[model samples]
Target: MAIRVQLTERQAAAREEYESFTRQAVAPHADAWDRAERLPEEFLEEFAARGLLGAAVPAGYGGAELDPITFGLLNEELGRGCSSVRSLVTVHGMASYAVARWGGDRQREHWLPRFATGGAIGAFALTEPGAGSDVKALRTTARRTDDGFRLTGQKRWITFGQRADVYLLFARLDGREAAFLVPRDAPGLTVRPVTGMLGTKASMLAELSLVDCLVAPEALLGRPGFGLAAVAASALELGRYSVAWGCVGLAQACLDASLDHADRRETFGVRLRDHQLVQRMIADMATGTAAARLLCQQAGWLRQDRSTESLHATWLAKYHASRTAFRSASDAVQVHGAQGCGDGHPVQRYLRDAKVMEIIEGSTELQQTTIAESAYHSRTRTTPTERVTA
Candidate 1:
């Protein structure tokens, strides 16, 4: 087991700090929050005040201004504690990053500060009732009005939708897709809460109905046609990276829980770990977690370099890490046996959340297609000299 990469001392320290805080504050309440189907506003406010929620915000905006790896570290720790909290941060980053990268001056000045300080919570609205995993099929309409734009459409599966103060929404305007910043208070917009979700129960997911919702002309995030290809893609790139790291955290959590259960629980007059089958499962969980972490680290560094190859790297990381989480969580439940199946057990929640991870930020099936296509093109582009046999 040679080391392929190493974290700097500063990075290690930062990760430890985040882990410590999450263990004390967030992890203890994850299951309870999930059962309640809501996350406390005060908890999110505290997170924002600590600058954990504003990883993408710059120093000028009164934020922590963390780098990609550090940002990933923050997300990882949060996921380890509670994925619902992590999802909130991920969705908020999508909205905040969009504004920072493409928003007009006024949009930036108004939104970034609020986003950093938690004066406003943000959510991304791209998944519509008929159009998820495929943004081109979106039917949301953006009609031009003299005073502003009139948006009419329904968005579904919006995380933090019930509580988000603003949404980074998308609509088709004259055959061109565009992005907009629609405040929660916008007239003709209605929010319908979605409960009984299989995972991330505290995420406050909701459906949004916009019936001729009017917004200022400045609401457009970028010029016409920049919605999917530019702004949404940019935000989703960060999202994939964040999700990849978060999955690593979830897998690790599963591994830790499984190990503890196996060590203490005795069956057939022996500890669970004494069984060969149980040992094999633990081995798989441990190795899978390590692989996921390695992939996430690779993705994080590529993101830091702003490399074109980073896109596929992120997809690869996300695909692998999410599966790792699902598998590990399943094994954790098996190790815990009856205890794991019981309500209020963290492993049960972990399994459910891990399944959800496989679907979001691009499903496992979608990533496979995209990665395969990228690999084919990459092999064709590489010089023969660059290929070496092991």
Candidate 2:
């Protein structure tokens, strides 16, 4: 489906450029990357050279400084080709944005250029064995030392962890959350790859072990006691936007595949597209795709404008789009019959990828709880004057 919202000429041009690049350079390699279970280093170099790797970083820091909505559009186009590639953008952008927003001038001057140029890869280390969604429950700790801090903990499910040059690692400092920029070469640091993920094989996932790793005072990002909140505020908004767009892309792909299969496949006497049930399924897919795209775009716009409802809108978009993607992909597979189950067919891959979208970043159940809580609080809250009067 075509985008319906108004776009600035520059945004339109950027989208066109991104779409062309993805179709030519990214889409053709998706199947091979999936089969290999690794993102090609060449792809990274190419992305950097094209300024796609750090498109959202500020211009002074060697980035394109594109607005968040444009970044979201770029992500959607890339996701249409390969979700794994889009995952790279999500993690990298999140790390860079976190530093830019909270890092000291010295930190920004030292790190932003390398990060934007792809001379350094950044990974956020937050998830742990004992703590997935509960930030306060994290066990990683950093103790004060003579000139710095000593960190010790295990971080799990870190994207790009194995090869990242720097890490935005989160740990507790004096009973408060803090973020540190831990170099990959930091002494006593170890990274182990995790395998068998259902999708996004091209993006590496690793477990990190920090055994008394030392970080200088300069390594700390922002003020102490704000790491968890900062990361959550930034990552959630960006993650929700990226994944919601991704789900729209997945739904569109499913709809296209299902339509192609239905139009060509023949039954006992006629083509599958001629059947009433097949038509109904295609109609459902199209409707879902349109709805998902609209919701995603609305969220993106709200985020770009920094609207008061941005948080709730983002959660709503992500929750609905992910469910729509999964349902559409499943229907696409059914439309393809046995061929959809084969490794050679793309529909099966879409199905697998769509299922992964439902679980990663934040689960559907989590989104539901967030939305409900937000709505509940919004309904019950009163102004200070109202409370006093009551």
Candidate 3:
């Protein structure tokens, strides 16, 4: 079945340009980056040169002003080349989007142009050692001062943490959640690099500690009590959109790898493609990919339309696509047999990368719970007249 999302000519061109950039730049460096476990500085500049970074930011802020769906398309293409590159897209785009949407004039003037040009790397610091899914469990605190706020807390598993020039740091202010912009050179701030990630090797995951990190009043994002809600809504929207598209790319990669291996490998004097089980795997992969892609695109369209159902659709897309990507990557690895487990193979990387997708942004179990709770609330909140008399 053909995918039915309508793409404007401009969007189509953007996608093609993204694909071309990935093929020429990111794809060629995947192995080297994985081996080094560091993203090359030059690559970031290349992304900026291509106008790929901060593509979703408004034109007034020096961005392309593209919609989220277009950004997703770009992410999918980048993921097809390398998951790390896709992750960079997610983190940068998400942080920039948050700033653009909720940031005040000063915040916009300070970060937007730098982000669009890749001059400033932004990281979202929300996940703490003690708090994963529960935002209320966050222990990071900020005390209001005469001049500004003094922040103290630790943020772990922060993507681009070590390399971020500025952090969108979330902390508790007077027992309420608040977010502040902390520069890397801020006093009493430290970032330590974390290792041993299954995928996204090039991304510099780190743990950040802030001991009386002073932030000016102008550094606050949105309102004091609304930080958690604002960040949650923004992050989940971007996470789901990016992950959904990344899953589609992963599925496509898996399909291509499996097909290639099956066509070349022989079993009992026949190609592996001739086997019924092999064909079934390919069919399943294709079906799952199509379903996930459609859900993702639908969510994106809803977001563009400013529909209330966008959040529900976003959760659905993330949950479904993460599962699909994991399954497809695992199956692809199985299809490749011993060769798949070998170091430096794209399938192995895909398998690792796919697993991380399930955990980041929000876990699969978390999304499932969100979906179920949403359904339950919807049913309970229905008007008596609207309720069926079964």
Candidate 4:
């Protein structure tokens, strides 16, 4: 069964605005950007100019402050243009929201305006070579100094690492975890791009190195020991939501591309769309795209309450959307046959990007574990009356 989302008039308008912008600004240039393996920094400024950089940030801070549904639509539209562009919005939104939620007033005053306006791009650093899914295994350390604190660590797979003006870095301090706002030009810090990625090639992924990176005590966000699962909880939820919507967009892109190809391309003296097998593939792609979109909308709606149930819904949304994107991209390639395999084909990029979506934020394997654990606990737990009934 499939679900449908009922959008407000305002949300509908917002969605159209974003879709038009993507068609005009991003879609035309996506293939070239992918080939170049880099999106020019000027593009980010353009996004900011259009109020797409900080969708969730408050108006007072120079943000659009769009509601959750509108924000999800924005991601979906951008994803249709290219996953690389969607990735930038996801990371930027994550950092902006995190600061608003956990940073001190001074920190917010200092960073939000810049982040909202694209004056300072933000990167989140958590994953390390030794630790990817296992947050506890992270070895980055933050030592308290008389002046403030000194951070020493190496972070890998950080999106936008090479271009970010600041990093919301996670590290352990005095055997407890915490978050620090580390500037890009901080002393003893380095960011080097990870060349030749399999997907999101133009996202500017990089490795971050910090040796005795120092910051004022006020740079610490939230309470002590607020890192990993604690400080990152809200950010992770937002990331998953954004990724889910992006997947929906990817699936839709695949369906649209497949349909267009089928209508125009001929085989065996008939149009490709006239073939029974090709029709099946197109049907599946369209169905999956619609289903994935509904699931994303469900998660976006649940997010407003910020309840435990909402978290589970987001996980399920991400899991389903990622899988659907991969399937749709594969079918799209098959439909295109040789055309899809070419370097310049958009379907090829979609296939590569869909694979990466499954691994980022949280792997498909990790999502399975979390979702099942939650499901099992919910089913097995017995209330007083339920226990008697059983």
Best by TM-score: 1
Q: Compute the lDDT for candidate 2.
A: 0.83
Writing each residue's lDDT as its tens digit, candidate 1 over 103-160 gives 8889999999988888898999999989988989989999989989999999998999
lDDT of each: 0.90, 0.83, 0.85, 0.88
TM-score of each: 0.97, 0.92, 0.94, 0.95
User: Which 10-residue window in model 2 sums to the lowest lDDT?
Assistant: 1-10
Give the per-residue lDDT digits (tens) of candidate 3, residues 221-275: 8887865587657765786688778888877778888999999999899999999
Q: Give, for candidate 1, the lowest lDDT window spanning 10 residues.
A: 1-10
Top-scoring candidate (lDDT)? 1
Query: What is the alpha-carbon lDDT of model 3 when measured against the actual structure?
Result: 0.85
Ranking by TM-score: 1, 4, 3, 2
| Candidate 2 lDDT over residue span 94-210, tens digit each | 778887888889989988898889988888788899987777888999998997889999999887776688898889988998889999988879889887778877778899999
Q: Which stretches of candidate 2 lie over 4 Å from their true place?
A: 1-4, 378-390
Worst 10 residues of 4 by lDDT: 222-231
In model 4, the runs with Cα more than 4 Å from the true position are 1-4, 226-228, 381-390
lDDT of 1 at 293: 86
Cα error of candidate 3 at position 313, Å: 0.7
**Evaluation by TM-score, superior candidate among 1 and 2:** 1
Q: Could you arrange the candidates by lDDT from highest to lowest?
A: 1, 4, 3, 2
